[model samples]
Target chain A: MRGAVLHAPGDVRVEQLEDPRVVEPTDAVVRASATCVCGSDLWPYRGINEVTEPTPIGHEYCGIVEEVGSDVTTVRPGQFVIVPFIASDGTCAHCRAGYQSACAHRVGVTGAQAELLRVPHADGTLVATPEVPSAELLPSLLTLSDVMATGWFAAVAAGVQPGMTVAVVGDGAVGLLGVLSAAQLGAERIIAMSRHEPRQRLATGFGATDIVTERGDEGVARIRDLTDGVGADAVLECVGTGESMDQAIRSTRPGGGVGFVGVPHGVEITGRQLFSTMVRLHGGPAPVRRFLPDLIDRVWSGTIDPGRVFDLTLPLDQAAEGYRAMDERRAVKALLTP
Target chain B: MRGAVLHAPGDVRVEQLEDPRVVEPTDAVVRASATCVCGSDLWPYRGINEVTEPTPIGHEYCGIVEEVGSDVTTVRPGQFVIVPFIASDGTCAHCRAGYQSACAHRVGVTGAQAELLRVPHADGTLVATPEVPSAELLPSLLTLSDVMATGWFAAVAAGVQPGMTVAVVGDGAVGLLGVLSAAQLGAERIIAMSRHEPRQRLATGFGATDIVTERGDEGVARIRDLTDGVGADAVLECVGTGESMDQAIRSTRPGGGVGFVGVPHGVEITGRQLFSTMVRLHGGPAPVRRFLPDLIDRVWSGTIDPGRVFDLTLPLDQAAEGYRAMDERRAVKALLTP
Candidate 1:
């Protein structure tokens, strides 16, 4: 199988790798139909995070089950499925509470940008739709596995409500989808803080009522101006950096919520600001599995077409180009068909 | 009029000051029957916070309304009332949402440790009982104005559930009452992290099922041990220090909530840890006005006696001693009879 592997910081390659098989009782071998480069992959590619050894590269995918372990009951061979970014046992206390991302017996399914992948806890982690999605809907359905679910988590965490104003602090795929999610959640107003023309246009199409082309203090000021001097009722921090975090905090109302979905890089929230400002903060690895079914339904019903985020597409053998395109900001999201 | 004034750090003196009068159309002058020292007051008294001049120092009080401004409609003259520490116009959007502390027309009502104090937005800031209660209930009712309500906010924010394990981080009146609040909220297991004998007893009396004497990492480990290494389902952070915040965060289960009512001092939250751990943080200056009616009813019916926190009582002239005792940790809370 061909997979994208990170040998070190700034070094990514598409190479031949051993095929994955169902080694665990709850595992399923998936023949990936579609995979994509994620924003998180840039962490190590940009040399911000250390890559000590060659490591598997993607975590988002939609695939067909080639084989299933004996313990996998819900999904079987020949089924088309969307694998949530996180694997869960489905029976743990946290999983029962609908926080499958923090499942007690959870494991990460790596090397998703490959021809084939092994998914653990298949019964809990994979959701199968009644019909196989066409290639035209593949990218949109693929997004349900990670980015869409993450955006939904940010909206839910921030408690976006009808007639409320929501601000998204990142211009990446998740942030763009966050705007869409907030709109879907009935937010009266959506403010997208982005300077990039392509992202700004996508944000507008994704239900952003207002666009602020500023960053940090100026961005917060712009949001406040649009909100009549009061900050947004809900803010999604989709860029995990000091500036982005500060903008998120400052852009939220005193008692409003800041849902941070971006994998934090150098961001820090001081206790003084957190308590004094009284903004509620909730985030982490999103419980993507909990939201997969509904998101898949939305995609299937054509209510939301998250696939528009993928401005570039390539074959599995060209995974390195997908990474490079996203890294260079030439594409918002890149889809790879295996 | 005589009031308790902070001339410098560690210097609280009962001194003569101008008598308070209705300064606005919505103001009301109240003749305080009682007031108290708060844990937050010690922040400035301990020299950690800069005190520039002789600042009027109390924010909690219960008193008789001596006069009302022309615009004050709900509260009239000669009515007994409990004034929330923050005076807010009940008409504001935030106030309507039960976040009166962040009300648009907010007024700080300190200098309550005096014979008379002017309360702004009297119609919305003061909650009146049927009539003046017995002297025995005065202290308990007075606590509802701040500390008690703050504790209740912590519990509510932490989302305490029946049969769930909870941890209260702080031994002050607020933290002790947090244990009581958690119990009232139906948490089956309450852990009060404290080393102070008096506070520990108070915590036990308030329904703490366990006590952890350690702080920070050790404290978190102890909480986890008590909960079978899963950590408490919710943690109430009543102390604003970085250490207390960290302990509260570490002691809660992944996806659990940390309701922090503590006025954050220097605590900081790293984005990486927050995202990986998946904790929800909620807090701020409690909307005491929102809970006053119910709490006052509870106190009036003898269901709760939060007055137990005030171990010492003194005349208004001896406000200095009350401050001294609380500053030295000799008293959890102090009551001053005017």
Candidate 2:
């Protein structure tokens, strides 16, 4: 199998690797149908997050199961399934609480940017579609593996409700989908903070009622100005940087909630600010597994089209190009097909 | 009039002060019947929180309205009322959202240890009882002005539910009443984290089913050990120090919440820990006014007795000794009478 491996900063290659097989009774071998480059992947690719060795990348995937372990009963061979970024045993206290990201026996699903990948805790981690999805629906179904589910988690955690104003910080795929998620949750108004024209257009297409081309304090002021100086009812922090997190908290009303789903990097919050501002803070690695079933239904019913986020697509052999496109801001996301 | 003035650390004095009068049209002059030294007061008294000038010390009070400005309508002269530590205009967005402590037109009610207090935003800040209350009910009613209300806010923000195991991470007046608030909110098992025997007794009387005598990591471990190693469903952070905040966060389950109401001091939260832990954090200066109506009803109906937290009493002129007792931990709370 050929998988994308990072040898060092700005160095990615599609190299022949040993094919994965079921190592445990709860494991399943999936032949990748679709995988993508994530914003989080850029952290290491840009040399911000240290990478000590040549590591296999990618954690999101939707594929057909080529084989299943003997003990796996819920999903069988040839079934189309969505694998969450975080694989869980499904029976742990955290998993039972719908926080599979923090499951006791959690395993991060990596190397999905390969032709074949092994997913552990198969029975608990994989959500099979009702039927084999057509190629047209594959992209949207693939998003359920992480990005779309993460965006949905941000909205839910922020307590987005009907008729409430919302603010979204960030212009990436997750941020764009957050605008969509807030719309699905019945947000009355949504302000998307974006400086790029293309991302701003995508944000608008995904249900952003307004856009503010500003950064940091200025962006927060813009959100407040739009919200009658009271701030939005809910603010989604999708960038995960200190600036984005600060903007999200400062853009929300005193009693409003801030749902942050971005993979945090170098972010530090002052206890005094959080306490004095009185905003409810809820975020972290999204329990993508918990929302997989409903999200699959939404995709199947054609109720939402999260697939539009993939502006660039590449063959498995062109994996390096996919990473470059996303890193250089040439694409919102890149879908790699094997 | 006379009030407790903090000239420096350990330098509290009962000094003559000018009488308070209704200055703003929205102000009301109240002749205090009961005033209490708070945990927050010890900050400046101990010099942890700097005091540049001779500052009037108390913020919690229950009194009879001696006079009201023309704009004060909801509360009038001769009415018996509880004045929340923070005064606010009821019409602000924050107050409308039940977060009066963050109200746009907010004012801190100070100088309550004196013979009279000028409460600004009287109509919105004062909760009048049904009628003149006897001395027996004064202590409990006075708590509604701050401590008890803060504990209730912590419980409410933590999303306490029936049959859930809750933890209170402080042994002060606020923490003791947090046990009571959790019980009133239908928490089935309440764990009060305390090492003091007397405070533990008060906690058990307030419905604490268990008491953990450890602090820091050990305290968190004890809470986890007690809750089947999964951590409590909700944790109330009634102390604002970094240690208490850390313990509260570590003692809650992955998806649980921590309602912190302590006045934060020198605390910093790393975004990585919070992001990875996935705990929901909500807290601040409590919107006491929001719970005033219901709490007053509960106190009046003998549904709760939060007044038992006041273990010491003193005449108004002996305010210095009241501060001394609380600062030295000789009293859980000190009630001052004029």
Candidate 3:
């Protein structure tokens, strides 16, 4: 098998690796149909996160099951499925409560940017589609593995309701999909914060009612102006920086909510500010397993096409190009066909 | 008129003050029937919070309306009413959305421990009872002004539901009342965390199914053990310290909720911690005015006896002794009569 490995910062290489096999009774091997470079992947590539050793790196993938262990029941060979990044036992209390990321016995699936990958807790982590999907449906189906589901989680956590005016802070893939999720959830209006023309267009395509290009305090003022000085009813913080978090909180109405899905970095929130605003705060590494089935169904039905977030594509042997394109801002996301 | 003033930390005196009158069209003057020393008041009385000047102190009161300005409508002269500690206009966007504490025009009534108080936003901040109550009902009625209402807000914010297990982190007056509030809200099992004998007895009397005397890590471990290793479904954080906040978060199951109503001091929360927990955090100063009507009715009907939290009674001239008793933990609460 061939896979992408990081030997050092900014040094990703496509190299030959041993094929994965079902080592545990609950494990299964999946042949990668499509995978992508995640924004989080850039953290290590930029030397901000440590890469202690050469390691196989991707956690998002959707593909056909190649083999299943004796204990597997729900999915079988030749079936297409979406894999939640965090694998879990479906019977755990946290999993039962729709928070699989915090499941009592959980495993993280990595090395997905390869021709084949082994998945633990197969029966619990993989959601099989009704049938094999067409080639054109692969990108959208692949997104259900992480980014799209995370965006959907943010919208749900924010309490996006019918007739709500929602504001999304961040112009990345997650933010764009958040606009789509809010639209599907029946938000009356969506304010997308972005200065880039292309991302703004993508946001509008995803049903953003308005776009505010300003950043920080000026951006908050713009949202307030648009909402008649009342601020948004729900705000999605898709960037983990201190400034974005502050802007998101300040742009929400006094009794509104802020659902943040960004992996927070260098952000500190004082209890006084949170208490005075009375805004509900909910976020985390998304429990993608909980929302997988429904999201896959939506993608299969063409209700939303989140695959548009993938602006670049490459062959499995050229995986390094995928990372470089995303790192240089030349691509919103890069899809790799294995 | 006479009121309590803080000459310095640990120095409270009953002194002559100018009589209060309805100065604004939206104001009203009330002759206080009962005012009490609060757990929050002890912050300054103990010298932990600075007392830069001889400030008039107390924020909770229930009284008879003696005069009303021309614009006052809902509450009139000669009516018995519960005046929430924070006065709000009741018509602002926040007030309309059930967050009166964040109302655009809000005033904190700090001189309630006096013979008379001039309350602004009279029509919005005061909830008039159906009729004047007997002396025996005054204590409970006065509680509707702050502590009881604040406790009820904690329970509601924590999302307490029938058949759910709830845990309270503090055992102060508000914490005791929180137990009562959770019981009223239909929580099947209530766990009160306290070491004091009297407070534990009161908690059990208020419907606490279990009492854990442990604090911090051990306390969280005990709660998890009691909940089948999943932690409580809802945790009310009544103390604002970092340790209390951390315990409250760790004691909640993933996807659970925490309602913290303590006046936050020196509490700092990192976004990473909050994001990783996936716990819903809702809290702040209680919007007592929003719950005043229902709580007043509950007290009037004898359905609840929150006033039992006040274990000491003092005449207006002995206000210093009232503060001293609370500061020394000799009394759970001090009720004053003019």
Each model's lDDT: 0.90, 0.93, 0.92
Q: What is the interface RMSD of candidate 3, in Å?
A: 0.9
lDDT of 1 at B305: 90
User: Model 2, B211-243: lDDT tens per residue?
Assistant: 999999999999999988999999999999999
Q: What is the full ranking by DockQ, best candidate first?
A: 2, 3, 1
Model 3 DockQ class: high
Give the share of true interchain contacts found in each model: 0.82, 0.90, 0.82
Candidate 2 residue-wise lDDT at B20: 87
Model 1 lDDT per residue over B233-338, tens place? 9999999988888889888888889999989888888997788878889998999999989998899889999999999999989988998898888889999998
**Model 2 alpha-carbon miss at residue A198, Å:** 0.9
Tens digit per residue, CA lDDT, model 1, A22-122: 89999999898899999999989888888888998999988889999998899989999998888999988788878899898999877899999999999
Query: Could you tell me which residue pairs clash in candidate 1?
Result: A271-B267
Q: Weakest 10 consecutive residues, lDDT, candidate 2 chain A?
A: A316-325
Clash count per candidate: 1, 0, 0
Candidate 1 whole-model C-alpha lDDT, 0 to 1: 0.90
Query: How accurate locally is residue A84 in candidate 2, as Cα lDDT from 0 to 100?
Result: 96
- Runs off by more than 4 Å, candidate 1: none
**TM-scores, each model vs. reference:** 0.97, 0.99, 0.99
User: Clashing pairs in model 2?
Assistant: none
